[model samples]
Target: PQLGGPIWADPIHDIEFVQKVLSAVSTNPSRFGTSKRIEGMLSMMTEELPDVPLYYALDHLCSTVHCNTPAMLQFRSALLHAGYRVSMSHASRNGLKTDAPPGVIWDLLRCWEKANPVKRERLSETSPAFRILSTEPTLQACFDVREDANPQSRKRHLVRFQENPQANWGPKARAKDSGGISSELEDKRKLCQNKRKNQVTDASQLKNFPCKRFRKGTCTHGDKCCYSHESASDEADKME
Candidate 1:
């Protein structure tokens, strides 16, 4: 429903696809630590999805307890990946400690300060949450464990984030729309291929939009290329 992409194609819905993996994580989250197998499984979603995942839908994906070292670091990394600017400011860092480990309010303030240091510093910072809300307002996961760092206790939290309609395509829609979505995805791939293919011949254009195949002159788009097919001299004259 948001910029994360359509349904299963986004990280906002990852908990749905990987519920089993998440469930396997126990209080000794170290039990299900980042192993080669887990990493490989995680890689599948990103490798298949268009771009790298922007943000993980960790909202409610944390335990009511406390976050352990691994969870804290991972949560911070998730915010960083989601384009949140983090700072090591005394105020922000100190503020972060008082709250659960997963909230990004302080990070949002850091981002705001970077963009408007003078005004931000000048203003009385009452509600950091309010400050965070004023900026780009999209709901993001801020899941954190209560007092326990045990991953097993967070199973329900993970499931909570999965209850979103965006995560569930509904059985009927899944059955009906699967083929259509696949077709659309294939069409997009071909379109990108053609765009890259046509970007050959013109070095400047190619640099800006390199073709995967045409770089080696194997572009099947040929004269049908959407990009300029100008030679070096021709390109120079055109630039002039």
Candidate 2:
């Protein structure tokens, strides 16, 4: 005898499993209404389904350069319209992972630049933006949003890229030693401060006494030597 309760079936080899499950739940509301587990399972299956590939094939598109005019949504829409699969990369908040070729990506960027014009005079001929904009796109790009432009994860409100847990959460400055003691290097730096500026330049202003190191032929300061390098005989002649 078949049970009266919900009969769970594995959606093996069923490409429309998600749609079928949703339909069944909607039609037989009382059967699934009492079960939170069923609801959560369906949610997970629909929204949390990972996009896996046999191998790493998608191209990563990220840049440190401050070109924020072309939003991710705009790029996604354009790529979708051009019949290419595109998604946000986990590596960066604004990064894109797509199967689209470099040429097509550049073309889309060119289209975006044309619509939202930038200061042409500011861009140099050698700059990437200028070079990309100079060339005409091979394919005419449409920024119209397609039904699939927005992924299921986004639509279901799944946590894609997590926000910063706390304010200013990133790389910090080097930690100082405990007890607020200044380091030996810092003490040495303080001692050496203004040493070059305080150095006497005029030979006449220098002390007539010869440097002991200069007499021993071991003085390293050369012309910048603060002490006089004159011999005892020269000093005696000067005294005379």
Q: Identify the leading candidate in terms of lDDT.
A: 2
In model 2, the Cα lDDT at residue 100 comes to 71
Per-residue lDDT, model 2, residue 56, is 18
Return the TM-score for each candidate structure.
0.22, 0.44
The 10 consecutive residues of candidate 1 with the worst lDDT sum are 89-98
Query: Candidate 2's residue-wise lDDT over 1-240, tens digit each?
Result: 123545334332243786687567657768854433343345444532134211111222222112445555767888888987776543445555566777897787667667766777888888766776788999999987776666664576644455576775655434455545443455556767898996767777776557889999999998788788888898889889
Best by TM-score: 2
Q: Per-residue CA lDDT of candidate 1, range 52-139, in tens?
A: 3233332222211111123443444434555443221111111112122334543433343333343334334564433543465243
Off by over 4 Å in 2: 1-67, 167-240
Clash pairs detected, candidate 2: none
